[model samples]
Target: MAKYLRNLTCTALFSMTLPMTAAAEESEVQDMSDPLAVYTQAGLGYTDKGINVKVGQTYDTGSDTSMGMNVLEIKGFAGEALGWNGRGADDSIDSIRFRNFTVDLTNGLGGQVDISWDFDSNQGSASYSFIQALPKMGMFNFYHSLDLG
Candidate 1:
């Protein structure tokens, strides 16, 4: 509430102190008519949910432990990526994700997957974790794969 009040006060003060501009200059600020703006923000590359696609080959060694032998597998998916901003100081919002992921069992890690994200103004005490059943690690149950901030 205090922050809201402060912002409101500042906006009101700015409006009152702004110097008057010529009519021709004022006319230059045209209202945007882009219909998509109604759905997303003023300028953005992705919609409420950005897109991500991955396709990779998975080959299981004969000794996968309790899971036993496995065949060649491929995984691909698409999900919502709504809360990230590239322009401002504050951009990452909260989101929920549900999907199936795989970790390769191949030696020397035949493939590499790189996932990147950015956060601004870190004020919240949040904990993030990724869980997966690792056939590569010889585990039949899901376990903490990684921890994120």
Candidate 2:
């Protein structure tokens, strides 16, 4: 009876390990020379629970030489689980979405500007808009504008 029990235990253990060994051999393992290749391979099995964002700003007390035009700027950004395929390989992510985003700018001369955008994948919708309120003289007065395209 002792010998029979030992044989049964060995058989059970070998049977369980056979499938695992086969699976490991079937999957190809490639040698990655670049760090980016390793990063994308490892990211395939990753997921996020959620996202958190914190926004802050700093004010400089030091004064700088300027042409006598005052400008105030406000900016913000927020989003969740936006994934990248890394090289257009189509790993798992299908689309991107943004909940809320905004930006505002104001000048000392009572000129103001606002920009906002919202995007979603489920509804297949996206919206982008901006508003400009400038004084009669205009927001900017420049001799030449730079265009890089």
Candidate 3:
């Protein structure tokens, strides 16, 4: 019975050593000589850093001079104005807005005209112009275009 117990103890000890040896062989040893190792160990990557603040302003100027015909005759508008917009990192601040603009019925068919500009992260600034005939049409249809930059 003593001999049997001794054999079992030796087998168990040998089996434990095999797993330790295999694990050591399978694992790789990293080179700590790299300068950025310390930062990497502290859970920092390429884009990880401090607060990033972005601020800027945008200027836009446009002009239109045309005497064209749609389904009906249309007048023309010729004016010059300077406009600017201030922005922050996100849209958490006020955006580009037009205030106190006057519209006069100089000639031709009277319609509803709307001009809007918005900012987006992926596609940048977008400007939209829409013109629709007033209560003349129930379907509410006219001409529209979008300028994405």
Model 1, span 72-110: residue lDDT tens: 111111112222232332223323222222333332112
**Candidate 3 deviation (Cα RMSD):** 32.3
**Model 3 — TM-score against the truth?**
0.18
**Structural similarity to truth (TM-score) of each candidate:** 0.18, 0.15, 0.18
Q: After TM-score superposition, what is the CA distance of residue 54 in candidate 1 from its true location, in Å?
A: 3.1
Q: What would the per-residue lDDT of candidate 3 be over residues 70-124, giving only the tens digit for each residue?
A: 1111111110111111212232212232211111223222222223233333222
Question: Local error of candidate 1 at 79, Å?
Answer: 15
State the local distance difference test value for candidate 3: 0.24
The collision pairs in model 3 are none
Q: How many clashes does each candidate structure show, in the order listed?
A: 1, 0, 0
Q: Looking at model 1, report the run of 10 residues with the lowest lDDT sum.
A: 34-43
